[model samples]
Target: MSFRFLPDDPVASIKLRPGQTVMVDPSARRGGSCLEVLEGVARVYCPCEETEGMTLAFLQEGDQVRTDRLCSEGICVEALTPLSFRSDAEPQEGVGFDSVNEWTLQLLRIRHLGNAELRLHALLALLVNRLGRRCGQWCDLPFRITHDRIGELIGSTRVTSTRLISKLRNSDQLDTPSGDNNLRLSAALIESAPVLG
Candidate 1:
């Protein structure tokens, strides 16, 4: 057993016996996860499924998964790969983590800039940046969780969320998928849409 922990450059290399399951605790609160396939495949379970059915997110060697920040686990996950996790998480922030670093503070400054276009564009960029993904120029985004849900996350609303996102789509800033099932968003659409208000 020759193992070591590396924080500066995180890595995981392990050979778990077949059928071995470690760290299977729900109270094991999670922040976020990104995975890379090394030797096998894995399934990420939807954490929020009521006892109905467990939803799975399949990942291959070249795929990455980002779970939401608040967790009681609507996304339940299981290893299809002989799992190796390279995790980066700080201890729980009792009052949130603004003081983590200068960049965090720099982010806050954008909120206070007082210029509408700059402020809105910056915030829009941040919104898409933080909650967006780009795979070959298209972004697979989170969609249709209700405008109120959007408001709950950013102090806006179901109507406001629908309106702003709608405006983005109309102005060509963002695109929302047609049905509730295909909420995956697109970044290229955002790019295709000029950045003018």
Candidate 2:
């Protein structure tokens, strides 16, 4: 029987059995691709010569990003780990891409611009709410990212992303715990920033 994959179900094609791992290839575009669960579980990795081996996004069973492309700039995606899954079953529902594609488009707009303006943060905050995985109050994801990748994806460099994150934090626009690799943002934090408009 075909498995009916739900919206936001445990991302399959991963969480495999013991000693199994799949080598997910680089996505044609960022954020979304048809991953092959050849071994165990997989994480999205972005290839950055500088960061060594860091990721920029993460997906569990049933997770898909940018299935729809809303921007002119193509999405950048790579696998973080070798993963595996049961590929025998067929999905009842077609892989949905609406929400993620919308988020990608909005983020593309933010990156294309030079600064992380207020309205931009507003949208990003929403996108984060919808796209990010929640660990208690903190929303997190593995964005195997680098300075250059951030700049390219958001139309800026690692330095720019870092500065913006710092600025947002200093202004109480975000909350990323000290020494944590990911940035966690709340609605209030993002909204507090001065509107770029």
- Please provide TM-scores, in order, for all candidate models, with all chains considered together: 0.33, 0.47
lDDT of each: 0.40, 0.42
Model 2 poorest ten-residue lDDT run: 1-10
Cα RMSD (angstroms) for every candidate in the order listed: 12.3, 9.7
Cα lDDT, model 2, residue 193: 37
Q: What is the alpha-carbon lDDT of model 2 when measured against the actual structure?
A: 0.42
Choose the strongest candidate by TM-score: 2
What digit string (tens of lDDT, one per residue) describes model 2 on residues 93-172? 46554434444455545554545454345444543554455665455533323445455555545776778767766866
Regions more than 4 Å wrong, model 1: 1-110, 113-124, 142-145, 152-159, 178-197
Q: Give per-residue lDDT, candidate 1, residue 196.
A: 28
